[model samples]
Target: MIADRARQAAAAAALVGCLLAAHGTAAADAAAGARLSAARCASCHSSTETIHSTVPLLEGQPKAYFIAQWRAFRERKRTAPVMVNLAGELSEKDVADLAEHYAALAPPPAALASGSDTGRALADRLRCAACHGSALRGTHAGAARLAGQKVQYTTWSLQLMRSGTRSHGTAAKPDPLLADLSNAEIESLAAHLASLR
Candidate 1:
């Protein structure tokens, strides 16, 4: 299983490289994405910066990553209950517009626990920037933007991924990194990410 994940990660890494070349450095247009979001996703993804624990913050995510996720949802490869049906209804333009809208918004700020020094080091060592970009923001590779994500949500999600109990999408490959963490490590990591500006 570990070998399989390594292979998957390698493939994903290559895909990310290709996407970077293709996308250059273009970020999405917030105005267009916002209009689409208001029309299509305002109910769950409230206009306010506050995000519920179950839902992820979409703002400031990379357009390419957001598009990729929507496509995955549409194809039934990824599995967010709320997203599965909705994704199928979105037109390609809607996907692009929404991506830009979320990407334009800033991540909401949150406080973190002190004394998580080791966790901070671990995050840096993970080289999350390799895919998520230097700012821990989503990049052209379709990585989810992690800066200022809710700590509880991030922690819960990580726990699920590690335990193989939570599924992001049906076809979503498990993150191999999550498989090796202890509970403390996960919490620390979550705290570190949530504290990002």
Candidate 2:
């Protein structure tokens, strides 16, 4: 009984320490984040408003996800040239600050594209629902939420998969059905998926 109580006490202390660290991190300077956003990310990406169709609206993304992506970019695991260059200069604290800033911003409206019958049929046949869920909200096992994502990013990711430039893993290979889709078809699907949110 005494050992169990001691372990519980230790766990409570650790949880308190974690909470304090999180609070301290959240209190980091917003001005520094604004400066970093302008200097490092504003050129190709928009931090304040949604103007570009190709670039994703980083605003309102989960801070944890944003931080993870930034770390991936910095490590070259993400393989995006723009992100690689931007993330390379950011320290861990800068990444946390930037994630906080972006997470606090509002998400932009989603643009829905009318899907061609062929594209819709293709999507249905390919069982996109299996991984993306009925609402495309993503699953916990690496499937990303397709809903509310930028259409350009969605299409580009599909194109990458089709061209074998990007593959999730051996267990999650690119669906062969997508390989033959025309650019217009891809765009239509992307727009349809984006409309979910």
Best by TM-score: 1
Per-residue lDDT over 1-197 for candidate 2, one digit per residue giving the tens place of the 0 to 100 score: 99999999999999999998887645656577778888777565562234556676665555666776777788887787877997887778898778667656654565444545665665677677787667665544545556666778778888877777766433344646676788988887887766655
**After superposing candidate 2, which stretches have Cα over 4 Å from the reference?**
1-35, 47-52, 104-106, 110-143, 169-177, 180-182
The superposed Cα distance between candidate 2 and the true structure at residue 114, in angstroms, equals 4.5
Q: Write the per-residue lDDT of candidate 1 for residues 1-197, one digit (tens) a residue.
A: 99999999999999999999787744445677677788778666543334566576676777877888788798887688779999988777678778777777787556443427876887887777776778787667667887777776788888887667655433244656667778888888888887776
Give the clashing residue pairs of candidate 1, or none. Answer: 33-97, 33-101, 60-102, 65-142, 77-171, 78-169, 78-170, 79-169, 79-170
Candidate 2 overall Cα lDDT vs. reference? 0.69
Q: Which stretches of candidate 1 lie over 4 Å from their true place?
A: 1-30, 46-51, 111-115, 164-174
User: How does each model score on TM-score?
Assistant: 0.71, 0.62
Pairing residues by index, what is the TM-score of model 2? 0.62
Each candidate: what lDDT? 0.74, 0.69
How high is the lDDT of residue 70 in model 1? 86
